[model samples]
Target: MIIERKQYKLLEKIIFEKLVIQAPFKIPNPMPDEACFLYMLEGQINYKTENQNVSVPQNESVLLKCGNYFSQIKNDKSATLHQIIIVHFHPKILKSIYSSDLPEIFKKPSFIDDKIDLSHINNDFLIQKYIENLMFYFDNPTLVNDDILILKFKEIILLLCQTKNASTIQQILSQLFSPTSFTFKEIIENNLYSNFSLVEFANLANLSLSSFKREFKKNYSDTPANYIRNKKLEKSTELLALSEERITDIAFDCGFKNLANFSHLFNAKYNCSPSLYRLNLKDK
Candidate 1:
């Protein structure tokens, strides 16, 4: 439950927001087109992603790439209530802030290898002070104006550029402006390895669930679940036969969160467990 909420906007777009909520509640980032910088004021949060979930602890922060993410606020006795500060980075706003000359960081590719949609920033004094200043605006809302808010938002961008994860941050921030367009099949193929829910896959494909299903069937001739499952299973077989990776690791790599489920599917598909399959392949 949200006990209180406050926000500041620029040209009707949410620039900064502060939220105080009761713990043990699920929260999803509703904004799909813009990335956000989330600072943990009171408690921690875990950003659910395709590959690995990223945790933002108290006094720390995370920069998420533009996408739908689900999060949870655990009921930790040490911190019962959760307070969060969100700074939104919209592409239109960025272009406006930089005027005709956009920053080079937004143009250059970071060539980041991890490809994780979220980047974690370690403890930084500048960001901590910046959060404190944001709290001031939250406390003194009446004094804020659009110009000041824009300046404050720009200040955050400058500070972010100075952070250790500047390249990765730039990489995420860059995607907002020089956005890449992927086809429905391309999008599905790119993220086929990870374990994403059908709804999340729909969001990635920029379609409603029903529309996504219809389009998927038209393009792939199969339901999303069956296609993704068979694809993941196929990848597991290739890895099991070729790589020295452990069965457990292969399960995770193939998007099965549990070894038992991977084993069951592997047995049903290949007529043997992953371990045995690898052993039999070695003998051949």
Candidate 2:
């Protein structure tokens, strides 16, 4: 059966878009005022941020906050197609529907701390059934109208709020609707302990790679690689001097992926390997 792209204006604030993916593809999309709930009916998708990457497998779902980010989708090796159903809606609609009706448990947070926000809802059989039914409607558009679609969207939202992952989902919604502000330095300092690559950092800052580099230089007076490496090694030295932990563990805690790389950078920064540096601290 030939699958045609189908869309429905469920409400003034909600839209449903159904698409299929056969080959791998990547796209960058700025976050609209509306958050998107993506259901992977039949393929795998890798959602990448500046700091994290999450894979949504077939029959699973992931909710994306309203933020600029990138998405890559690839069909399974044995599968013939990857199907996706995305519900996009403004935060206002949720507020109008549930703000007073929802319990305190479902309320959005006033503020969220700076951290990696990429997460997915675990296996939900009910949501799976909902998406299965949604695919039927996509196939038979005549069965769907504004009222039916609105009910479907509301059902999904209420079901989501009742899931075990409700707190996380609420946090994401809070961030989407009421985002906090952070200066460049604050963003860098808070994320130093994270293992995000440079590209990821840029994405998190909502800056293009070159622009991020320019701004980072203006703020820190150093290149990103050099500044971050120095800071990581500096933190490693503090850990070495203050704790009795093994050097390899310390290396990982400082965001170094391998002992050798940590050792090399440590020697370059302090003129001694991490072990030797700790040994010196002990001698003192």
- lDDT agreement with native, every candidate: 0.80, 0.71
List residue ranges in candidate 1 displaced over 4 A.
Answer: 76-79, 110-114, 180-284
What residue runs in model 2 are displaced by over 4 Å at the alpha carbon?
Answer: 1-3, 11-14, 74-80, 95-106, 179-284
10 residues in a row with least lDDT, candidate 1 = 70-79
TM-score of each: 0.64, 0.56
* Candidate 1 clashes between residue pairs 3 or more apart in a chain or in different chains: none
For candidate 1, the lDDT comes to: 0.80
Per-residue lDDT over 1-284 for candidate 2, one digit per residue giving the tens place of the 0 to 100 score: 11446688733644787876553443333343446788887768777666567889887888876553445553335235777788775666666656666545335676654454555876799998888888888889888887787788788877788888877777666655564456677668856755568887887787999999999999999999999998998899889888886776677667775679899888887887778778877898
Q: Clashing residue pairs in candidate 2, if any?
A: 50-200
TM-score winner: 1
User: What is model 1's C-alpha RMSD?
Assistant: 7.3
